[model samples]
Target: MTTPAQRQTALLVSVVGAVIVALDGTILLMAQPVMQRDLGASVAHIQWTSTGYLVAVAALLVIAGRLGDQYGHARLLFVGVLGFGAASAGIALAPSVGWVIVLRVVQGGFAAFLQPATLALLRLAYPADRLGKPIAIRTGAIAVAAGSGPLLGGVLVAHLGWRAVFWVNVPLAFVIAVLALTVRTPATQRGNSPRLNVTSAGLLAIALATLVHALADVPARGWTAAPTLLEFLAVIGVATMLTRHERRTTHPVVPPAVARSVPVTASMALLLVTTAGLFGALFRATFHLQDVLRLDPLDSGLRVLPLTVLMVLGSPAAVAAMRRYGARRTAIAGTVLVVVGIAGLSRLGPASTWMAMAAAFAAIGAGFATVMVTATGTVVGDAPPGYAGVVSGLKQTAMNIGPTFGIAVAAGATGTAASTMGSTLLILAALAALGLLPASRLPRRPARQEGEHDTTAALPAQAPTPQAAPARHTNS
Candidate 1:
């Protein structure tokens, strides 16, 4: 068993890993314009930097998760961190946009390995009863990283240059590596460890790539473009094949039995819908603030502060609510809050003030924090022992895909900023409403002892049974 000090050290390492993953997501967003100018990339090529990362992250998450289970999570995490740091360096020194995009994909693959293992490691490090506080702290770290990345990236890119944004990961990575080396955790090995389902992985990757391409293209090519149609078809076909393969395989990426569980399925579904809406809102709002509202990059990043603040404040409250009200109720409430928050955001117009924008973001941030914490708890809590890594990968897959779909749908819709916002929120509200049906199906608490005894006593009894005959004949 790990000592408390070791557990604490593990949590710190996990937190650092999470920060690095979150940082990568936003850092590139701010650096895109600079990279385009420096590398003479067309808009399409520059956009690939983000698109490739998302696709790779989504595709490899499950594989990485299983690798952690088969090998030691701590070992996999160390390797992932090292790989991610190296990829970041490559991105920093890339001679062309093409190489940068390639490295971003590699970085994302490493990120996939790191993310689920962090949570799995935490589960191992902490005891069940005491897990809430540490999970809350971890959630807070995620919120902080999410909120800070844009601003930090903006500063680095402005003064130091775009390459500096990637270079910043080096120090953080080194520190995290040192901390991770100190953590003590149990080793894991799968006897006759399953072979890599290379075919499934390839298919899924292709599907995600096509889907992202379709989404990205919607902004440039009208939705009716033939390429978009073909890409969509390709995604559907690949997904179907992948699903069939997983269902038939002895050692599937997502075991069919686990995926069919009510709690697991519900949690995954909730994550998918929530991610779609939240990421869509972020993408749209970012563009709206910068493009339509004409704010500078620094100001734009600062304007998003309210969401971060609310996320930080609300995460602990969410965990508390889960304990008191149960995961189902807490998740339902959170989804409602998200609906309200998105509605508030939909009200924004060209004339809206920064304060108004901030208020909307605050609602979204708090609402999402509630949903995220509860949903994660529900998923992890319901996962079977020895399968945490697989389930986590599934969850991450939903997370990655949802945002891509959301961005596609939102960007495809025709409207002014206000109208687009309204449409997107309406879609989010619909998805949130769908979450209520499943939320209602969570297992009910067992009856109290007195209630159970009283119920037993009320049952009708059969007639008294006669005693069995003795074996007296044999003695005679």
Candidate 2:
């Protein structure tokens, strides 16, 4: 029952939210060197600015998604956008490195709320058959934000001052907030009214924090450090306890049955691998471009333009590919492209040409666009209606974790930055190759026909009852 104008506004809001999230990831890269010099920080301390953001985003995403479900998505979206903007402003005005880090954590927390709500809003706003176009548009926006952030950040940091990089979000957020007010809330209702499980949330946060600490310390202390080992063990133990507690709770954070589903598990795995490669490449590429290639921040950002452009260009084709070949084939094809792209990048040396790197980025960007679109569709399509928030949260979590793990591994690789990048790219390529294994197992067509009676009557009353037969393959 949504009006066309309403849908348009909703799409705009979601796109803006997504762009902000993407910018959050890449914008800081350009500002890092400047901030370090101004704040008189060590390399490790500067790196934590990005790490802290990732950790905060990862830890809070699920809880935020649930809050959107319990409260209202539109409301949460507004709050998140405003909070994010404020935090950005704080970062812009901060005098001390510690203040900047604290503000980044705030920005990440707000981002957590914004991201999942955007996805939930999209899922609610569009019908199933027509979802492709909007999702494609959303993917395109994310690519643009991510691809442009470095360049934009570089320019801002060099010419305007590093603070300008953050100030930019304030105006953008205002525009998005105004547009957001015009959108209609979806008709979906939460009947059970699940409350936030404080204990579970706390435990999960601690687990992630511990993991990040362990990862950060591993290189310096090695695996034998008593504290690192203890933190690792604590993370496992806390996570195990959280899982058990959630499973027994009447209203679990992530429902046990849904988490165990093949589609959900597979989709999460795809997200983890794809994001790890994409973010890892971004991190390393930025460093290599600036530190090794002697490129200015602006130049470094510009170097990644090919990747961004290709992602935008490749989105529609990816959607079409999904429709024609089914999710499995489309995903596998994308993964192959990612593998090729990473392998190509693995060939980079100290003397590699800019054109060579651009080509590598372009390949990776295309692959990333394809896989991201496909993986998102597959995960959301397979989720039960009531659990969309949780599914989206899980996707966000995987996305965050992927980058964190990738950076940890890549940073730890032996040799110079160029050599380490080569090795990391190869590892990423292997991960991309592994994606084919799961892609092969996805059902090639819809699991249900256009119209069929429900067979599983014992499912929860609130769950959407399936009323269709498995869609038959036309060829078969």
Candidate 3:
């Protein structure tokens, strides 16, 4: 039987691995200047530090999430943490930029193993009705880690040099890995494992990769351009084939239940849209802050902390808000706040104070936290017991893809930095405003009373679907 203390230990362990994975995405950007000089790497080569890792992570996410579903989440967490630590150590000691990029890519592949599993594991950790604060906390941790990356990178690079950033992850990964080994594997992890639908998995990777590449190209080549349009078309065709193949296969990578779930599907859309708007707007605003306002990198990084801080604070606030407003309304309210904040950002000007911008970012961050908590609780809460990892992976995939889309949109919008950024922010506001579609679609479940402390409240029961594997599974 899963004990409460063991459950908490598992969640605690997962967060440590998640922090390192999240931090790497942005920390290396700050370290690039120092590393570029030290390693004699050209700008093109250095950019791969992020590009290679992210692409690998994106490509492997779906397959890895499925693997985590088949295997134990705790087992996947340990192995991923171990590999990530090893790769981080390798990158820290690398002699050339090429070697660093290669190691980073390896690290990214490992990093992919962390997120979906961690998300899936969270559902197991807390009961459905009690999951809001934990989800908020998880989302907040990721946002804080990503938000703090640059500042932390700047500091480490300033003092211990760029290598320090990778070194920092080593001990963290080590601790998490050790803790993961101790978590009692859930009953599902002890039985015979099923094989992944490799063909379906491959198709998903190709489709996702093509879509991401197409999105990345949208800035330089307009979306209507031949190559961009072709890529989009390619994604559509692959998606069709993927769906068809999955339907025929007895063991589809993404089970029919998960793919067809309204909460899961809708939440994934919101995840993608919200992240795109949130991160995309943040990127453009950073450029303005750095170039127009002439703030140093650290200061520019610090300015965004309001977003992270408020996001973190939103964890505790989620329960009260959900109690008063319930999940669907709370999510809608949060998304509206995101839209309003992006609109607030569009008003940026030469005279705009950093404090004012910080406040605006804070609003966006809080909204992000709320949506994440509400949507995640409902989606995961409603998932059939056996497929939490699949749903979690889809959610992570959306979040991962969101920033790329946002960056592409920001890049494609033509104007002076100020004009461009303002337009981009407005575009993001519109996208965030679209979140109401999904938010409104969220199931109108009643709320738990604020004074309720129960974690054993049973989730709303779901009927088993044809695609659902037996609950007894093994760590394959």
Candidate 4:
């Protein structure tokens, strides 16, 4: 067993990596105009600095996660962190917006690699019973970073310029990469051997890229646009083939071995639904606060700072709820809070009342905290002994996809920013309501003992953990 000190180090390294990626994901928004000015790029070109990154990460996250499972999480984490650091520096020094956009895509790919490793490492290092707190803390950290990223980026841009934003990630990634080399976690032990079906992986990559691109176009091009329709058609066609291939293959991207675990599936669904609403609400809140209220980015970020703070502060309570009342009840309560939060946001009007906005943001953050903590812990805990990476990948993919869909839906709603935002929040409230049933379905507690390692929790209790499940090779 690893010492507690080592586990702490592992958590620290993981948290560091998570923070940089989460921050970079949205932080650049505050600095994009400055970047455009510096590069003499058009609004559309500068915009891809963010859009391309999102699409790339969404496309590559599952593949990266599978690779981590096949090789080693720690090995991948080290490479990912180092690569991200290099890409960040490259972006900072780029002379043109196009170069920066290209580098940002590379940065997102590195983020996909590092993200799954962090979760897999935490799952491996900690005991099952004790997983909630660490996961809660991890979730809280990432949430706060993501929620308040613009605020931080605004400060960096004002003081040091846009390049400072990317430059900040370089040091953190280097530190984490060094830690990956020095620290020995269970992730380095070489366990599950995930097989990659080239055909399926390629199909999934293309499908997701096309789907997200189409979703991204919804706001600008409308749902009826030819490009959007064509993109959806491509997604559907590719997905059908991929599904057929996965069903027939032994070592598909999802790994037929652990694909059917109800608990795992439910957790992923919970993540996707909750994040969709929560992220949508966040967008609406930002637009309402900044666009309607006429607050500057910094001011808007500051106004919502309490909401970000509450996300971090609320975790201990969530951890307590999980321990005392069980994950099922706690998660149910949390899902209800998401509905409450979105419902509160739906009440937002042309005037951004202080009390109404404050309360809504708080509810969203607190509620999302519980759901994120619970879903992450459950997805990891319920995986079959050899498929942590697979489930982890699936979980992260839901997360990435959630915000994409949320932002798209909210953006596509009719009228001005505030009006459409209000519309989307109402829709999100409905989505949150639909999530209630699944939230209530999670296991009361993890099925495995704290010290028992592996994805064995999803397997029959009496079954031995598949310590070395190898990649499959089809018969000729």
lDDT for residue 377 in candidate 3, whole number 0-100: 71
RMSD of each: 10.0, 3.8, 4.2, 4.7
Candidates 3 and 4: which is better by TM-score?
4
- Per-residue lDDT tens digits of candidate 1, residues 114-233? 888887777566533345566677778988987788888888898999999999988888787777778787443344346557777677667766776677677666578898888888
Ranking by lDDT: 3, 4, 2, 1
- Give lDDT tens digits, candidate 4, residues 1-476: 46889889878877877888888877888888988888899988976887788788888888888787778778889999999999999999998888998998998888889888888777666655567667777878887788778878888999999999999998888889888886665543344353578888999999988887787767677878888889999999999999999988866888655566666777778888888888777777777777887887777777776667778987877877776667788788888888998898778776656777778778877888888877777787655434566678888888988887877777776534554666678887888777777777777653333444443323433212444332110000
lDDT of each prediction vs. the true structure? 0.72, 0.74, 0.76, 0.76
Backbone clash pairs for candidate 4 read: 128-450, 384-455, 385-455, 385-456
Candidate topping TM-score:
4
Give the better candidate number (1 or 2) by TM-score.
Answer: 2
The residue pairs found clashing in candidate 2 are 449-469, 452-467
* TM-score for each predicted model, relative to the true structure: 0.87, 0.89, 0.91, 0.92
* Cα-based lDDT at residue 18, candidate 3: 74
Clashes of 1: 0
